[model samples]
Target: MLAEGPLEEAVEGLDVEIEWKPFELRAEPKATLRPEDPYLPEIWKRAVYPMARRLGVDITLPTVSPQPYTRLAFEGWQFAVEHGLGDAYNHRMFRAFFQESLDLGRLDVLVGLAEEIGLDGPAYRKALEDGTYYERHQDALRDAEAHRVQAVPTILVGDTRLEGVPSTAQLRKAVLDERARLAASVTVEGVVCRADGTGCA
Candidate 1:
């Protein structure tokens, strides 16, 4: 939620393409955290709230107990990507979780969110039931593992990795540096006798 807004601002008008990859902190079989747990509230008060305030973002630690496993949500993301609604789906997912406290783990809730984003509700529900995007989601997870992504908000600019929550200034600088690196690496070949030859260089 926090990273999305700053990321948009950072890449505005820049020759950059942003891809939001999936990384599950607690993928299946593993127990998820509960908002009622002391650890959650403590971390929120100590770090999350402070960071949100610094970034001028209104965020809250959700009250959902045994937080919903996100595999279903990510699978829905795969469906959204195929339908050209990836960005909208991502934003809505964040809002539904943090602001609206919607259960992303529920099929009905996910289908409703998909409909809200202009996707065919029944088609999406059927896809989820049939596990249409299950493998695709798994592929994305493997890609994240290959990249050694161990945390959320792992922003990569060129080969540089920015972990955790990053300020807009930090993102902008990384983008500019990456652009400069790409520009420097591009080599142009000079043509000889270009004026006399129809085919040259």
Candidate 2:
């Protein structure tokens, strides 16, 4: 939530394509944290809510205890992407979890969210039920591991990587810097020389 606003402003009218990837905070067999847990509330109070308030994004600590594992939800994401509704699916998922307190770990809930975004509900449900996208989702997880993603909202612009929620100015600067680097490389390669090769030096 905190990253969304700043990210939107930073990439506005820029030739940037945002790709949302899977990063499960509590991947299976690992237990999901409960709001009753001191760690959950402590971090939310200290960091999340303050950042949300500053960014003017509406987000809350979900009350779902023993929160659901996200493997199934990410599988649904693969389905959504195949149908060209990937971005919408991601936005709805975030709203469902953080805002509506909906359980994403449930197949029925996932189908409902998919249907809400005009995806074929039955097809999505069948895909999840039969584990059709399971391997695909696993492949995505492996990609994330290869990237060594240690935090959420990790933005990579050229060689500049911003972990956690970055300010709009910081994100904008990284993007501009990357663009400048690409432009410089292009300029060097595009230099013209005389046919005689006298100006090649």
Candidate 3:
């Protein structure tokens, strides 16, 4: 949601598919953030959180106890995307974590958001607790790693990978270029097929 420029223009005509990839937390070998620094949660609430809300829908917070299994949960969320549930949960979870400052790593928080969004809270919680989507989540993580997505807000524009929050112009250019490429690769008959059996029209 950390975006610049016209939102509609940035997303217009884009065949973008949203996925919530697992959050990877790697230890910073050279640390810069100190306890004296401003609280990131508060900062997010004041700035980034609001921006995210304006951008799209928010989703539920997960139960994060004992330790933060960010990778597992994020991958699970991404599986939801594969099954076409990304948009709904993404919007909810983002709001809860950034805007509401809720602990997204908790199951109760997740349940609350799910209930608010009219999802079956108990069923969803059971799924998470029982690791119902474990395999799917793992597969998503593998895919993300294969694509070298080490950061959030990574945009896969056709074969191009843009990491971090991209500018409106950059996103627009990517979208346009992708469209042009698709167009060029297509045939007038609208049934073009690749000799390698990779594409069809």
Candidate 4:
């Protein structure tokens, strides 16, 4: 989604509500990833590589994986999302971890990132330390568990869940299909759009 902003552009004209829920992958927060997953090579080659190329992300496999906990970043993103930083922090974090290999598990690092995005650095640090937004992170985890989201980039479009990094075209099509489905369920007026996102779509 970060690559080229395709998802954002795809839905710009749809008037659809987009909700971002950030959470860690494991069953618990602040869990560490193993040094190696044997299938990482295949996934890197099959999915991540091609998607990065197609999206022009310039994404690279980390030379030295930080294996950092994303919980702090997810909690800190509450401020970013509220402040309208426009994904700057997310992009910065992505670059830090993937390209520059910065450790995300540090408070000072995250605070600096917040400051870079024009957010209140000290205040964000205070809030993070006070656990003010931990509940929100927990809520996100609960929602993720409820959705059975076992993959990264799981997007919920109506009743359908598109897991992993889905193509921009597929994301747009899902939005249209879900919109049509919801419109058809209306009692007073039933407006059915084409399934291909063509007319009335």
Residue by residue across 40-122, what tens digits does model 1's lDDT show?
Answer: 99998999899888888878888777899999899999999999999999999998999888889889999999999899999
Query: Regarding lDDT, does 1 or 3 come out ahead?
Result: 1
**Which number leads on TM-score?**
1
Candidate 4 ranges beyond 4 A from true positions: 1-4, 27-31, 34-42, 63-66, 187-201
Ranking by lDDT: 1, 2, 4, 3
- Using lDDT, give the best candidate's number: 1
- The per-model lDDT (C-alpha) reads 0.88, 0.87, 0.59, 0.75
Tell me the spans in candidate 2 whose CA falls farther than 4 Å from its real position. 187-201
In candidate 1 the C-alpha lDDT for residue 94 amounts to 93
Q: State the TM-score for model 2.
A: 0.90
Candidate 3, residue 86: Cα displacement in angstroms equals: 2.5
Residue 30 miss distance in model 4 (angstroms):
7.7
Q: TM-score ranking from best to worst? A: 1, 2, 4, 3
Per-residue CA lDDT of model 2 for 105-138, tens digit only, reads 8889999999999999999999999999999988
Error of 2 at 157 (Å): 1.5
User: Residue 2 in model 1: shift from native, Å?
Assistant: 0.9
Question: TM-score of every model?
Answer: 0.91, 0.90, 0.67, 0.80
Tens digit per residue, CA lDDT, model 3, 38-99: 56446556755565566553422222222233443464464456455666776676666545
